[model samples]
Target chain A: GAGVSQTPSNKVTEKGKYVELRCDPISGHTALYWYRQSLGQGPEFLIYFQGTGAADDSGLPNDRFFAVRPEGSVSTLKIQRTERGDSAVYLCASSLIGTSGQETQYFGPGTRLLVL
Target chain B: AQSVTQLDSQVPVFEEAPVELRCNYSSSVSVYLFWYVQYPNQGLQLLLKYLSGSTLVKSINGFEAEFNKSQTSFHLRKPSVHISDTAEYFCAVKSRVGGKLQFGAGTQVVVTP
Candidate 1:
């Protein structure tokens, strides 16, 4: 793809439900990231992947939030036992791996999740 | 650990007026700084970055930012802003090696006619 792509631009789920959000990074980009943005706030890092492995997951918030990139190209973010507080936009970004400086991160349109 | 702070949550300015958005960060190691803009219903777009060299950096869109190492600040400024420039701006920082970004809360700029 020419740019990072996220599926299901919006999602609405009831409390305690499970939801999955998908992201497809640009081709040949080995670094992928996930972020969550609440109303009136900046995007908060959730996870980062280098190739098929998770380089960092410390920012996942809790056990209910999980993400995986099995092939290093497509990633999925799963939230279990969703709470109303989980309502936010989930963003995905990709960058070329091993870029010494702060490489530009190409972001997707983002998935707006509304936990009712 | 790294964190970014955007002092203003919202800023209002008339079209063609000068505007400045303040950002600061705290980090133990040397860091790279960036500013991103998000228009309505659009993904984030990079505005400018400060990796090394001169303290000042300019974007193609008439926006500029100065990185002050002593104060740990990277403030964005525009001499003349357009109504089309109204959007949400975010300040982010990351370790030179680690690609993960830590972002400020964000500042919403509203350009009134």
Candidate 2:
């Protein structure tokens, strides 16, 4: 009955620092996704995971951004050398099915990251 | 590449008035369309989606969207809205069956009583 959950609702870090955002998907969900949303803008795709491996990571902006879902249930988005432009809300989503794309994605509360 | 466009950046309306949010998308391949709503300081929630079959799709909360391939648009409409309906609405498109979704800028609906 629990929905997707994220940790550290808000995070503030200095530029050039690193941060990790965690996401816990709903039980029995195999597909997980991460998105970034700037102020007053819609969310943009970041990465996707189907089980243990990333099905498609083309959405990732650069090599500094990476994600891991070792157990296939929880995922962590890693940002290296954070910049002011990286300041945004990081959202996580999960669905019962993923490969088919028909399943509806359930979103998390999101973690607001601020780089100063 | 797939992209979405929300025609209106903001839509203000009085309570009990009809409202419509326009959306258009561009993609070389067939795509799935969806509308999501986000309340202040909250995450996005599914409002409605157009996958296949009937072109018209409705949500449980008095919201509906129609898929138009010719126009490459999927507009959201609510005949009569309540003040509580104020929020940001987004139009998104998925080019592949299980691929990344491209989202529009979003429309902020401000409902006045």
Candidate 3:
């Protein structure tokens, strides 16, 4: 009965460095999603996984933002050449694939990434 | 594409007072509405949702929201708020097919004694 969990509750890194944020979804969830929340702003969509494959990734800001879910259970969000503009809280959520896609999503505590 | 608009950016209310946070959404197709709350230093938690069957949905904590299809609005309300209710509340919407969530800027609710 564990909820979604993320690693490195806070991360501080220099500009141009690469960072990888990890997320572990619920036990039997088949759907995973990633979002980014900037200061004073709402969370924006990044990518989504519908199993081991990437289903919708249009929300990814640029080529530097990439995510993967190899075993359909755990996911990793990779950011290359982190910039000061990339500083924000990265959120992960998972849910069961509902028949009407109306399932409630459970969110993780999130990892706050600070680029200096 | 879907978008959510929270009319109030911040609201200050006294404990035991009634509170209401208005939320309006725009979408081409049918969507599901939700209310999420975030306490300081905590992650987002699902407060309530209106998917189907009921125009009014209530959470266990005495918060309730009514879905108005004609107005494209889902506003959250509480008869009497507690100091513990002070937090940031967000309004989000997603397509019925369920791909991603589009969130509003959020409303900060401050409850004082």
Q: Point to the candidate with the largest DockQ.
A: 3
Which 10 successive residues of model 1 chain B have the least lDDT summed?
B94-103
Candidate 3 lDDT over residue span A16-105, tens digit each: 999999999999999999999999888899998999998899999999999999999999999999999999999999998768888888
In candidate 1, which residue pairs clash? none
Give the alpha carbon lDDT tens digit for every residue of A4-38 in model 2: 99998999999999999999999999989999999
Q: Residue by residue across A1-116, what tens digits does model 1's lDDT show?
A: 48999999999999999999999999999999999999988999999999999999988999999998997799999999999999999999999887685578989999999999
Per-residue lDDT of B37-104 in model 3, one digit per residue for the tens? Answer: 99999999999998899799999999999999999999999999999999999999999886899999
Q: Which ten residues in a row have the lowest lDDT in candidate 3 chain B?
A: B93-102
Fnat values, one per model, are: 0.82, 0.73, 0.84
Candidate 3 lands at a TM-score of 0.98
Please tell me what DockQ candidate 1 reaches.
Answer: 0.82
**Of 1 and 3, the candidate ranking higher by TM-score:** 3
Higher-DockQ candidate of 1 and 3: 3
Q: Per-residue lDDT for A86 in model 2?
A: 96
Candidate 2 residue B93 C-alpha distance from true site, Å: 1.0
Interface RMSD, per-candidate values to 1 decimal: 1.0, 1.4, 0.8
